[model samples]
Target: MEAFFKALLGEKAFLLDNNSKMIAPTMEGKKLHNLERLLLHVHVIVEEAEGRYIMNQAMVHQLNVLRKEMYRGCFIVDNLKRQGTESNNYKGHDVSNSFILSKFNPVKRLFLSDVDIHRETDLQQVIDNLSNIMEDVNGIVVFLNNYPPLYRQPYSMHLFIEKCMFRCQMEMGRIMAFLMQKEDQGCVGVLPIVGPTFVGKSTLVANVCNDARVRNYFFQTILITAHDINSENISTLKDGAVILHQNNALDQNNERLLAIIELSGDIDVVAWNSLLSSSSYLGRVSKMIITSRSDKITKFGTTQALVLTFLPLEAYWYFFKISVFGSIDSNDHPELQSIAMEIARGLNGSFVGANVTFSFLKDNLVAQYWRRYLSSFREATQRNVSLFRESPYGLVCDCKPITQLIRGDDEFAVWGRYHACPVEENVPMITMKDVIFGRGNYEGEFDVLAWKSHIPPYNSYIVKCVIEKSK
Candidate 1:
């Protein structure tokens, strides 16, 4: 495959430098500024689709990349001016730091492989370049590391044929009406997307990112957790842009609310009013989206707020299978699937709880861990699950429930109580060693089991985010 690509492009596969075979590496981490870092370039030129249907997905997959470049790096798109029936919008981006993805249209044959396609850009370029793959292969390679879109955009609007599992229960009519029509001129209605955790709240936001109309109107995403957004956060979004708020809790700082009022023109609000409210909320053309387990947010916002509900039974089944078994079918575990479906029904439409429960249930269905996870699920329902809480140290825990109510700012969702401990001023940052090895009876400031820290941020923040360990 490398030889074929090399033969097609006639470019030096590797630059001869001091007679050493070097791997072409990305320049993101290597230097503060550099480009043209693509180690291997696959160029296909097509003029005639004759001779063995010369387009194969496997061949493209065999290349250094699976040719599924959508989420890999920078991307750019240019649409040819052929409107009315078929035309794509123009977009410019840092190609050196973007991923390019594509599909085999009727005009072209694409030999792709098991590749994760994120976003497709530049319809004209994609069509023309893909169309020209049979002719000549000569292009540029680059190296740049752009942050992957945390919330992936959806497919092309022009190409949208049907809604998938993610769009279930979302009232497009309501959204389109709210986004397009502006009645009374001073209403920025809110919509609360109610669901348990992981039930596609974030995924819904990802879909919102792809809508061409929405993207054109909005700016960057500012994800605010209960601990993140505050009076300080509003100063950040005061300009013209959209803010994506998540992990919102009522206890977040009042600063964010004040900041919303200060924001300049045309910032679409993608959060619930329960999450935020102000006298000035009416002045902006913002559509607030809130995903929560409760409905208090809707009451606080404009009267026209829409309710984005949970997935229908069918969609839940699809999501369950995908998140669990990696497929949309039960495969061979029909009985387990039935049990899982019953559990979903019992979840009361909380996708988050269902997902968390399913994650453990799927893997440990036959192990002791399965029973423990299931039991935990049942226990959690009775226990009032809270968000983050204040700690003995100055820093708050963003991932655990509070012990006791200690004048918490928004960063710490002040809900419960804890036995306060005065931190000795110069303790660097709490670490796992402090949680386990530090010789002191940790009186209820926080208690997390010894094992939770095995993960990344949790492992790093365990000492700082003290949880009360269960005996």
Candidate 2:
């Protein structure tokens, strides 16, 4: 709970006003009370050990207790005890907020006066008592006990991840390669850069969008995430004046599609076809980018796709040096730099973790430090994964698979296993477990792994994520 709370406590509070002052206390106690109460009834004991560490007899037992008491967001069945609802979803507050309300209540209590408990935020009154309010609230901090999937970076983040790793997808790249070369800019629609989950489709397109030079060219760049490929709620994303052609889209209409394609006036051929079919009016204008973790919708014929590969060790060295220590010409740490680059090469295309490891190395580090990092990087991550996925410690539960796309057999084919590789500041030397961490749920499931690598059947575009799995 403390760990999650810390991860959430950012420099600026999202719930604040223009002056950037927090305005509410919204009691998470109610949510926590409900979960603990449920646990107690089920004979699941939560012993408060050292450092607020919770010790329960069995996780399975805790799961059972959760099953009975879990309200909206955790399970499909609505928890009757709290809000008298039939389905698992809570009636009002979004699941994410409910989670924040529950997990951070500990540190939140420290800033109780800042929280507007009764829906009314009287900032002026609290302002008058600022000294009094801050007296009891001497810096509330959350030590690292856990990390939410947010820290994993979105599966779509492969876009940036690819730039750092240099393992960019060519399906989107080829289209850009063509568009940049040709005289004609194609129609404006959601250019479906279809590929299996974790296959670099989203990452590739996102990188192009993220490029500081190209980001403003589009009216809006949105990545819609869904648990299932086909979801009706998907329409809500396009309600505003923005583009919404990614993620689940079979259910979307030509109208929503039109809203997006028209928003950007004109675009390239791939995007034009995706947002609006050649059949629609505005769809005729060109330029759009679409990347899907699943083939929820089907339109337009198949096109050739270029599979992305890992960055060369040489590229990793340049990125690491510039991103961390900011220069490759460091005369002070030539030996350390050499060892760091070697370790970075071993990381494949995982630039994030490589960066983290390198940052750790910038300190009083040498051969011993490098060796220790190599020995423990993998284990630390396995432990971290469990912490990342550790359900909202009751108070409510909602689960979404961490999206990962390993290029299966279908070249340019259509994707888990959560996670690609670790993103640390320094390139930690890792062993077998680190590889296992990257391989994730696919371990021992050879057929699934093989099927993931198979790319022949789709006859469609396949893209790979930033990190590469050796297997």
| Candidate with best TM-score | 1
- The regions of model 2 sitting more than 4 angstroms off are 1-203, 210-217, 226-237, 240-285, 292-303, 321-325, 328-334, 363-368, 377-471
* lDDT score at residue 368, model 1, on the 0-100 scale: 39
Q: Give a tens-digit lDDT track for model 1, residues 1-471.
A: 335555644443333221122323433222101111231232121101111111233332322122222112212110010111111111232221111222332111111111113212332233333334423233211101111321244332111211332333224434544544443544454555444333444445445544455444443224333333344444333343335332243333321221122111122334333334532532233455544544444454554544455544434443454455543334244334434543453354444344335435555555234333333332232232322111211111122342321122112111222112223223335333343334444444443322221111111112234334342
Q: Write the residue-wise lDDT of candidate 2 on 55-96 in tens digits.
A: 232432333223222211111111111122212322242323
Each prediction's whole-model lDDT (CA): 0.32, 0.32
Stretches > 4 Å off in candidate 1? 1-169, 182-206, 218-303, 309-318, 328-331, 338-346, 363-471
